[model samples]
Target chain A: MHDRRSFLKLGAGAAVGGIAAALPSAVSATECASNIKWDETRDVIVVGSGFAGLSSALNAKRQGLGSILVLEKMQVIGGNSAINGGWLAIPKNPIQLAQGINDDSPEELVKDQIISGRGMQNTDMLRQIANRALDAYQLCIDTGVKFREGFNQQVGGHNKARAIRTLHGVGGDITTKLYEAGKKEGVEYRLQHYVEDFIMDGQEIVGLKVRQNYRFPDLKTGKTIYIKANKAVILAHGGFSRNLVLRELVDPALDKTLDCTNALGATGEVTLTAMAHGAFPVHMSFIQTGHWGSPDEGGFGWSNALLSIGFHKGISVNVLDGKRFMNERADRKTCSDAIMKNRHPDGSPAYPVVFFNHDDHIGAEEVTRAVRDQIAWKVDSLEQLAKQFNIPLAPLKQTVAEYNKQVPQRIDPLFGRMMDTAVELKPPFIVSRIWPKVHYCMGGLKTDLGARVLHSQTLAPMKNLYAVGEATGGTHGGTRLSSTACLECLTMGIIVAETIKSDMQA
Target chain B: MMKTLLLTLVVATLFTGAANAGDLVKMKGSTQGRSNHEFIYQDGCKGCHQGSGKQNATDAACVECHGEITSIPVDESKLAIPEAHPHKSLHYNQGASCLACHGEHEKKAPVCAECHRTWFKEM
Candidate 1:
């Protein structure tokens, strides 16, 4: 731990500038005028131990800067990234190209993002993601984020088939590896430390006031410690999904009805700390929901594999009339939005019941696995499934007949989805009714191509401050595609790391 | 929020230990609110913690009294909606230190409320 007073005195002694010594005694120390002394000092302080934070720390350490600290508020290291479904949506990547699905480029990826956001996403940020998509993916591989072989799976909302998941199929694998990579590069970590506010030196952010040895949610109970950052403070602490009041301020629909899919520590205060320091925020209202959890599960359960199974191998129907509704093949946001827009015949929000009859199109292994995992609700027949879901029996039977007929012909005139000729009926239906859960926040603090947090009004880089991953917005505007959240983390991680390296050295 | 706010008030007053248990030892409040948290708190916190001026209750402490733990559903097994893991998510099973849903300082998280549909309801 380095004393800010002593450090200031040292700086004053070393530099010709007299203000370094004068400001401590005469003027305020931070934006909030915090009088707390410094507890520790580092070249850079990375918030949140998830992929983005760890990536930044690793990059900073690789640049040969000693004294890099990764502070995580959570008891565990990873934030939502640990619990996230481990799929990186990279455009024009070698995996997709080698898998013979490379018609889509960075341009297409950006276009999809813009279209998904309803054209609200920043073009420059999206273009950067598109152009350097592969570079980011490779960086993750270099950091030991191992993707399973032959597992370049395509997820929803993406126009082309381009995504690779971790071998464990969870963000834990990626986050753990990133943490290890940081450790390998001699990056230090301070877990269970909550950042209370940003320390400002003149107009530039120079340090942070943190709550050391902090309990998870009880905010008022921790030791106040200040840490100075010599070069910069990267706000990679993630988004505000967990903060209900803050979330509702932007999207009023995010009232208690919507459950945040992020970790508990993802409250907006970290971003608010930046905001308090004049770092402008953008798209705080444009939140994104995953829209694929069971009305039975309280939050996002372990169901990424199950969701893929449901979307790819099953047909989704509205519980209202037992009829096929929205294009189930659409991206997660599109499916979730359609569900949110519809009402049940009884005035309840229409629940999407995804049913897969043992048409044998889906392998027995997956069916058995889903059943064993208890994610798949298996019933004796379609009648039982309809009864379980409270859907009309006759209409559901008719809808399945129509869908099965169309599946063989490889044409869905209603939705234009190409269901290949692999689905063949056998017996015994397995089903699960799912709805949307508030998954990700598409809008956040605005940033530029260099991954620096920019002023909301002027859009200029906030000096000595940067944000990456879900903390900074613009990569996603109105919405984000499936498997893209992790991709954004990696892409922004590399960009910010390199930028910080060059800028600090320069 | 009203329920969680009230519950948070209860939790802040529930534990009378030290402010924080330092950087390494993860801290959790004693269970005293609605749902099964009261009983869980007794079993996990009461036996060993016993007002020891500490704040470290864990899943390991949970399994000590309850035997092998897999799920933490608010409702019965038959009544709860279905999921791949439901209450027994791998993140929790694989030793996620504290339950994101189980907050001693607050009501069980809203993730549980999303399906149960009575998140802030006073029970």
Candidate 2:
């Protein structure tokens, strides 16, 4: 890795030359700051257009920070945030209070986050997320994000029913509004501007070497130019869950053939660039594979909607044993790990199926589409379901009978899953195979409470360099809970803007 | 030597400008309505991409020929399932970029499949 000291020496050499050197024949991200002529200058350059980046730019511009610019590497804005299920987990919020879930607090929320993250959380950052959770939800509202009323559910790993879905149940509803709000606040967004590296002045980040109008997955498409950041550069470019090389680098156990739910642009280049500049990477090996992903269809497909419904209304059973495995409503890591353990002797995932009754009102439209796509099987009876998946019919019937007995008492004798309003599953079942997709990277560049990127060598804050959202680590340590990434991103966006404003005044 | 150098530069520039177009031409019968070559031949690289600047295909370019997506009526009879109306969506009806899902050079599945199994064929 290129150190700050070597870049400082290059800066010194460029200063001696006096004239800006022409860009070298070979495209390189690491260039001496002194030898570069900035194509444009912004007071603050937010390197992403997701919830974190746009929120930072919008909040910073609202705070009267001048000349803020948001850069998106893809042709589109929002990155993976555009396609996410817009479920923001906030504790003791008005939504929860209205629903009679009055037993949640910021302390409780942080405790749950730490529990899900396997106790390796940066407690301070988790507290920041917990404290600002309501504020983050309000930010979404103020920015014109319409939350669906009466759609709040207790997602896996959260202690309470604090997760609220957006109006359309997709995150684009949030991002499109955030983008529009940021634009209205005079925050300029330059899409297709791929930030390659930080242009450093000694140890401090001064500017970025960006490729403008860059085509995705194409290395030498856009014209490389350096843009000076007069105040700060906020790195909110998200994690590398889709990048197979980086995924294999940290966790080789993750199958190379596994599908991902991330936007095609969710790669490791930007995070890797920050690491090259001495930003410390944390929790790199703690990648989280989503338990809801369906093996039958590509990406985060229709089966996801059904599997979530199946958690509460149905049962998830291993096809081999024809019996329920782990709790369907367990934490994401626990569920994914449980599914992974039920592998064939050849080391392939058993690809267990989650099934709910066909008449269940939970996510009907989603199930219809999944069945149409042939990813979900809608069989008439338990015998047909067992026969279709080639499972033992007797064992399947016995498992369902056992689950039915527990449903009446609202108790699970086997795995201790919540059985609220769950009835005995009947005929005409909707069954879909469950396979783990490289969903979210639980690890990224480590940041302090102030959202400043920390340097690996000195363990000090990298001056004028900040990070937020999934791009920064330690908020959710080993594993992330459902709906919290949105909360963390929105919260960090607010916190980073305040921190940047304070730094500017100082 | 100078003539040869100048020729190489011109060829390299042209090659870089339509590098992705080469990938499009190879996928002859893969597209739904028209063959990949027909779109390239009739419209040219600049038709979809809009310029030689190596930028992505603009939504405006797509809409110019395809018309406004949201306004197009889906015949419910032809669809295999209900709610298969690909054009009219809950979010960003006309505002979403066409290139977000429909890739000419690189074949991309309908991004709706990313979340829902809305098995709408690629336009």
Best by lDDT: 2
Minimum summed lDDT over a 10-residue window in model 1 chain A is located at A16-25
lDDT per residue as tens, model 1, A1-506: 23445433433452221111112222133234355556778988998877788777887777766688988877666777877767888776777778888488888877777887777777787787778888778778887677878778666667777888877677877787777677777888766787766777646787887767666665534456779988888888888777776778788876555555676667756786677656778788888777676655544664444666667667778887888777777776677777676575565666677766655535666565556445567788877887777888999889888887887687888776647622643347677767677777777777777777876556688777989988887667777777877777777777787888778777
Instruction: Choose the strongest candidate by TM-score.
Output: 2
lDDT of each: 0.67, 0.76
Go through the candidates in order and give the clash count of each. Answer: 6, 0
Off by over 4 Å in 2: A1-30, A99-104, A150-154, A298-305, A308-335, A341-350, A355-369, A381-428, B1-95, B103-108
Write the residue-wise lDDT of candidate 1 on B9-51 in tens digits: 4465447553321112223453233332333344554553434
- Candidate 1: stretches off by over 4 Å: A1-34, A89-119, A153-162, A297-338, A341-352, A359-366, A386-427, A456-459, B1-123
How would the docking of model 1 be graded?
Answer: incorrect
